[model samples]
Target: MTIPLVTVTGKSVDDKVTVERTGFEEILPKLDGNPDTSSDDSVNPLERGTELRVTVQSEVYQAWGSVFEQRIGTDVDYDPSTERVSFTLDGPPTRGPPITRAAFSPRGTGTHIGKFAGTTCYRPTGGSSCTAADVYLKSANDGFANCFTIEGDLVVERLPDSGSLYGSPGCGGAVIEGQSFFGERLSRSSAYEIKGDVTFEGYTNIRDRVELLEAGGGVHFKDDVRIDGKVKKMRGVTVDGSLYFDQGSSSNELKIGDGTVIKGDLVAHGRIKVSDTVEVHGEIYTTNRKITESGGGDGLVDETGNSKPSSEIHKSHPLSQVRGEMRRDLTHMITSDRPGRVDMSAKEPATGDPAPDLTGATLDCDADGTAETCRLGAGTYKLDHLILGHGDELELDTSGGSIKIYVEGGVEVPKNAHIQVLGNNPNQVEVYVEGQGAGSDTFHMYSGSGAGGKVTTPQDKASKFWVYMDPSDEVRLKQDTSFTGVIYGPGNAPDGDGVDIYLDKQSTVKGAVVGNFEKFTNLATVKYDATLQNKYALAAGGAARGQVAYLRTSARVVSVDS
Candidate 1:
């Protein structure tokens, strides 16, 4: 595709140049490269002045240069020492990449004069987008004002002592086509709206209103955050630290991770899962589903069902609210009325057929490796059965890409076996087991007398790991084995094929384990990471539109008398 270019020429020494668009070649040398080559190819390169200073009026800019005989500008000064010379003009500022967008870093704390076309990221120092310590958006005519909408992501990272994002009074708002991130803390009086997923990595003090219009990826806060204004229609949010939501505000499917605290009143349309030792300073209000507290003696608390303030929590059976919700969600995935078909009258074997012979099975590691140690590379492998004995080391390497291990029978990772994941990201590995027809799939992990080896992913990529089994399967994690990932099985099937998850004594799950029925015994913990909902949603081809539609189904309006 041909890119239309704009040229800025100085009539005299006192005149200045203004760029109304994003795609413009560099007219003057700002660094080591010659600027004269960027001028009109028909004009003589030597005709342009040798030492010239060109001031840009846009927040984003891109310049292309060609070969020239002599030197262009001898001395050029551009702020932000980490700026690069070569940049691509993606498209017009209103449009994204593959068009006329300019790829130049804005320097100084002054007003920028250009617009951007594609997703723009500003890091401290990188080739991607803007990464300045402090960014100032001046008058509507300056900075990113000319661009009505950013066709891509808009990320802003702050320096250690940097302040909040500064915008002029005339700045209406910003529309980002992709995700938006603010690395630093914002003041209590700050107000803004984001169309994509928003993340706040630092301590954010929220006093004013902040709206996330289309949070398809969900909102994440890594540190402490307090919301004083009303947050309406937010879905799938995770707070690593303490979260304060004002009274009477509503959200959907909120998960509070481990070691976090929640303050103020919270109303959710979906499930509200809390982890061990989490302290809720205020009451929880659920409009549709119930609240499940992991590791705590109080089991599932249904805010809509029994109104005795609380009910006898049962760990063996699924929460009444959860059963209904799961059935609905599973129905969306499976169409048949008998979604999970398994005969309840048929007698099933307690254990799977003795591990099938490994004669034709694909081997991931060398045959010479002893039961104590083994190594596996990333790829797709089909196995009849997978057995990891005690003290055995199974290293799964997925640095190249994601690894999928499909087992046709059962999987047994006995106690004390070391399962180390080489990749730091959890999304790098997936294990699927297609058990022997109905009610035969089994994942057994017996407890050892002492501490067993852990099956965990790196702390940062904790949510990437996944394990999928048949609808009617038995998954048991016993005695000191820690797992950090998602375990997805079938929902309730009264006629038979219901999944059962048993977390016995000292077992801890950092992510989620979804099944038809779950039982926790002797200090077992299930810390729900709410971000996984969004991750799983995206993985299932669900759009990350931020808000939950079900919560907004019934709307009401009331007039207040002044």
Candidate 2:
């Protein structure tokens, strides 16, 4: 439908004039000091207490005043004070339809036409304010016509089934200046873009491209997504499916969770950590580089690139010469009985011992809604201590996404309890335990036989689970428990009191184990997975860093009053 054209002339009129009509109705003031109603039968003569009914197409319009009732359709130019209606031949309204106040809350599946000066929230039911969890919109065409800035979040999701209020399932294009959340089975029909951080939670679907112009908070995708545009400037990202950054995205860090089969090229300036196995189709570029320049110099390799023997190379290379000097000093420390003399094997823990006692607030996962007796969903959990009782089976479910657990104290897994991860994809769980104080934190796994209570991830995709503990802490893997995953304890023997990792009573570790000091007793075996080195390599750079300089330099200042 075409927008009606209108024109207005004159400031005030003493007499009445005939309202004319072309192909469309035209409001002409009859200001000749007499009531003219001779030609048009639809309008009554200008007199006191007269009701005028004028219809232009199908729209019904009404204007409120003290004297008379005025009705016009489509476009009408009527001064509220003068009680006069005029028509213009101009184009569409110069500005969008003016709303009296900002912060509008629209109710359910119909179109709302106006330009909101402030925030616009969509709710399933009409209310005095917008405070609902989810809002549904069929389309955003007319509803968000000229709204360029929104000061708050735009939430669009499906209403609950029990509520009488409901809305259409999907929305059209939207450009929001604030954070956006599309949750709970809601879908976007066309391109959806946001200036702030955006999250897709609980099975929401996007039919077209989605873009984030400037997001400091990061984009978190808990479900699958196949987008057509680039995502930029996110601090970090955690994804469960194939993420294709079509235009090459940048982030400070990235975590590829389980079920992620394919990923696009990442230009990370910080770190890109993979949980399990991830197939990257594009190059992984990083800005962090150790050696900036390479050439021949004083006592180093020459530009001619001539090969030399190990003894000669060690004498010439600065780093190798330093290492040789350190080896000599260490040899003296080992042989001599000086005050600073060192023993290499002194840090290793004594054999055949259970884990240390754990003391902290108990975390009941079932009570906190994070887990049940049999199943646990993907989420980040913070706890004081972790304990799995005997004979209880707890399954970690990563089908929804990844799970990260952070403990401040210690962990205890008793005999006869089963804690296993259940998912097809690898690298779905990471457990981090920080030392509470000196000699207080420890990781203990009890020994048992014949269906013993063992804690383990999937054996085939053992690299998916990563356990990182403090350097001063002790980790004890008791008898009859087969562990599969990477164990990382950070510290060094000469520099500090290093970590102690003990494997006892025929326990086997399928993945690699790295600690400051490790001991194996009673036929325990550690079959290191050499391929894990390449899988979890600290490559050039992982995800691209945020372009803060570019964003600041590119922004233009505009007057808010204008």
Candidate 3:
């Protein structure tokens, strides 16, 4: 290809010129190299200009049937810092059909600007596409390009290759706007590494092990993938589909959303959220990061100690109390007449009265039997292993103190059963406290006597203790059986101090009842449909069998004539 010859000279101050397009020889001689010798003959370079360097402002430069096209303006100006032949073209005109390729060393003194051969061809499939990177190597037909490296920011709207992108170690790090290298895999076997950032809005599938020494953006897998190396550290490793980490590969910061199925142990130094069911055969440990659900729901700990669904809760400041209080104050509630005065600590000590020394004492009901007309005084009591029956009631009139009730046992209160205290009426009750073993002092039930109603203590003041009730016989309840008390852990009397109440679904209970009363935790075998197995069921707020109607709370022999 014959080169174009054009003069490049600016005399004095009046030598400003403008042109749309021209050849390299027209401007090269005017830059700083040679003024007389043409830019095409490869003339022995001469001191082109002694004073001001000639400047050519043109949008196009052609040589040997090739054009270096620029978009807006091409202004050649003298930069005092470099004092070299310098010009700035507002980049190449967008990106059209690749016409030619030129190699130029932007810096360094005697750097050679080599000319390499290349093909300027477009994709036959029009628009743009890519290939999933595998393990093969690909190269452009550029003699100087295959061995050279590209530094600085190399932006590409899309780069679709069907082979591996091999970069010399000197390529340093090239940032790609889009992520997935469709058919071309990136191979760093030449000791070259991606030391910069790779922002992929798509999936990254590695046919071989990916050893990332430093990466800014997180590795996102938009589809199913298998990684083969240990992920040192990543911002957020998201697997939109399933992930199969090879034998030795592990992820550090993993964010697994719904539709993710992982086949390896995921170790994270940060929080991990899983919105779907996760089944892992490997161990998982979160040292400090809390696991939660991305979508909203109550946080629960499954039987396997795995965190259930819930939103993320940020950690509060350390060394501070991070607790949730379950308090509901009703101080402004109306009164149904102040309770009548009952002098429990009177000197006369009436018969069938609960001892005043029962304060700070514990009471427990028997598992095998029931306590009829049993009454208890105020005390910090632990009620366990017991069945309370026959109008059994516990009343407290202390001031400025609350009670703590913890029951691992079952409790029940029949209809119309009186468990509260009458104005001055009291009854004999047996209070039992379980032994904490050793000589820790156990409060035994009234096993060898008629009835006991006093509090047992090891000396005078007692702080911590348990209560074990005496084994008694059965306590039956007719209809209208009212008991104002608390019951826990339903089971047979021979089974220990737990209380069990068998009620038909038609029975009504008026007292506040909590805990699973259907004796669910005590069965030998659990059925698929959660059968009570001839156990008990409570019916409150009017419910009965056969009649489809509820019983009224008023006192009467409300008889069925049939």
**Candidate with the greatest lDDT versus the true structure:** 1
lDDT against the true structure, per candidate, is: 0.41, 0.38, 0.25
**What tens digits encode model 2's per-residue C-alpha lDDT throughout 1-562?**
1223244545554465544333422233332322332434323233422323333322232332211222212245455454454442211111111111111122122223222222233221233543211212222322322222232334333221221111111222122333333322234343344322334433223323343332333344444343323222222344443343222232233434322233333333233444433333333344332212222321112223332123322111233322233211111111111111122133122321111221223444322323235455665555566666665566767775666666666776666666687777643566667646424437777755444446576544545566666666888877777666666553433223335666656665655444432334444544444334334411111011110100001122222220
Off by over 4 Å in 1: 1-359, 362-370, 425-427, 437-441, 492-497, 537-562
TM-score of every prediction relative to native = 0.34, 0.31, 0.17
Enumerate clash totals for all models, in the order shown. 26, 23, 39
Tens-digit lDDT string for candidate 3 (312-398): 223321212211111111112211211111111221112222234232222433222554344434323343322343334444322
Model 2: CA > 4 A from native: 1-374, 435-441, 448-451, 492-496, 537-562
Model 1, 232-271: lDDT tens digits are 3333444455454332333433445433333333433344
Global local distance difference test of model 1? 0.41
| Model 3: worst 10 consecutive residues (lDDT sum) | 521-530
Candidates, ranked, TM-score? 1, 2, 3
